[model samples]
Target: MNESIKTPSVTDEASTPQMKTKCEHHAECMKVIQAILDDQATEAEKDHFRENIDKCIPCIESYNLEKCIKTSLADKIAKKPCPKNILNTIISKINS
Candidate 1:
């Protein structure tokens, strides 16, 4: 009697890279990401984000987190009513 064994495929041994943000410019990265999403970023900021996104995983993660926060806040703002008194208060604070 003869027994045969099948070889495992390369995919069986292959590992996936961890999805993580490794960027050093955590604050700047998040700001850039937010600015991009909001369409408030300048050309220079866009360049910065593009350059660092590939190199820094931490910053990328931070960027994603900031985006999530911004989206959530936008949804919240959409749902809530801005009281006129509160609006006045904010305007007053800004003017002060």
Candidate 2:
């Protein structure tokens, strides 16, 4: 028998406050969002992101919007491979 491991989705994690620290400003929230999306955020940064999402309605909405867009694009790209011509064209442009 095979067992599957379950991981929390971004929405799941964002739905609750994992830490008590409340973010003070929108700019700070945006920075945390960028870090999280870039996968360059430390654990503390991630904690701040989560805390802000829980404490700030604007942050929660922004996180949800970004997450939805990212997930949607990833799903679409996974289902459709880029055409070789377009890929080569992009490579050529980069090399130009």
Candidate 3:
């Protein structure tokens, strides 16, 4: 006889807070995810959000999308300072 291994199913309510529901609306979950990535969420909050995100596919995808946006913005903000000589040359070329 062949036996199948049983795996657990993840429901949003299983990981979400008592006040929150894993229903059709996801704006609240997305807010939690944003706070998580921003590091504004406390450890407990982070854990709660992470747990919920781990279970909710839509929330997980939204988190990943937001994370990428954060990464891209950070990259832009951390761009290397322009060299003075390069800037001067560009200005000169522009004026020519």
* Clash numbers, per candidate: 8, 0, 0
Q: Residue 74, candidate 3: how far off, in angstroms?
A: 0.9
- The TM-score values for the models, in the order shown, are 0.51, 0.52, 0.53
The 10-residue segment with the lowest total lDDT in model 3? 16-25
Off by over 4 Å in 3: 1-25, 78-96
Per residue, candidate 3 scores C-alpha lDDT tens digits across 12-94 of 54766453335365887777877888888878778777577655767767888999999999888866899999999999999
User: Residue by residue across 1-96, what tens digits does model 1's lDDT show?
Assistant: 335766656775465334444555567777778789899999999998787776677876677887898889888875668899999999999999
Q: Please write out the lDDT profile of model 2 over residues 15-80, one tens digit for every residue.
A: 866643444587877778877987889999997776566667778777788878888888887566
Question: Which runs of model 1 end up more than 4 angstroms from their true locations?
Answer: 1-22, 79-96
Top-lDDT candidate index: 2
- Give the candidate number with the greatest TM-score: 3
Q: After superposition, how far is residue 64 of candidate 1 from its true place, in Å?
A: 0.4
Against the true structure, candidate 3 reaches a TM-score of 0.53
